[model samples]
Target: METDKRNLGGRPGITVQDVQRACEALRKQGRTIGPTNIRLELGRGSYSTIIRALRNLGLSASSKHKGGE
Candidate 1:
């Protein structure tokens, strides 16, 4: 059965769900991963992507470095 052939261009690899799962795994280990780190782990370079995911999970992203400096 073949009819519509439309390619959604994207590199074949892990998905956002996979990224979320990985974040969960890190959380369980008491490890914190910022949006930047998440992007890196998911092989993505966009902070917006990571931030959106975290926000969806009710997690907040730091706007600056820790230590309140």
Candidate 2:
């Protein structure tokens, strides 16, 4: 997936892989998977950028934990 190339706060780019990793971690912790949680997990990226990456992974803010009810 093509990630946002623009730099933010002097940090590197936020890639789909990054978001996927963050989401997985959040899932393991039973945490709410959203832009705010994700940003806190990664310590970077904008809400819009995180949202786009989550969409690419077929996930949303309201997504459930894998194999969970």
Candidate 3:
């Protein structure tokens, strides 16, 4: 119920860390989180944003894991 206009969890624009946090949250709920899901959560247009985050996280992101999204 706490919402701030600025830094909506970090910054005005979405960041890789934001997507990663969302993914980790989904995983905690026992749901499979992927780039697509992260994009949706971040209100992004494509998976590229998520891919960038994956790369920054040192993830392979070779379409073999994370539900192949």
Candidate 4:
């Protein structure tokens, strides 16, 4: 299987600050802060890339859902 270039290469240009800013903007607008939403807000970033950024920001998806289905 061919590896996805986006996920197999060097560090993505996206920064934690960028993710934080996007999340803050979305929060102010009462929007959900998921990977898809963050990617849309960024205009450029893969799912994994956004997830990593979110992780760096200490806002990983797993951290949101706790002790429930």
Query: How many residue pairs of model 4 clash at the backbone?
Result: 0
Ranking by TM-score: 2, 4, 3, 1
How many residue pairs clash per model? 0, 0, 0, 0
Look at candidate 2 and give me any clashing residue pairs: none
Better of 1 and 2 by lDDT: 2
Tell me the lDDT of model 1 at 3: 13
The per-model lDDT (C-alpha) reads: 0.53, 0.77, 0.57, 0.66
> What tens digits encode model 2's per-residue C-alpha lDDT throughout 1-69?
244333332356787888888988988898888899999999988888888877778887667675573
Superposed model 1: Cα runs more than 4 Å off: 1-16, 28-30, 63-69
Tell me how far candidate 2 lies from the true structure as C-alpha RMSD in angstroms: 4.0
Best by lDDT: 2
In terms of TM-score, the best-performing candidate is 2
- lDDT tens string, model 3, 1-69? 222112232324666667667667766665656676666666763466566666666664443335434
**Candidate 4, superposed: residue stretches over 4 Å from native:** 1-12, 62-69
- Give the candidates in order of lDDT, highest first: 2, 4, 3, 1
- Per-residue lDDT of model 4, residues 1-69, tens digit only: 322222322565666667778887777777778887877898976777778767666787533322222
lDDT of 2: 0.77
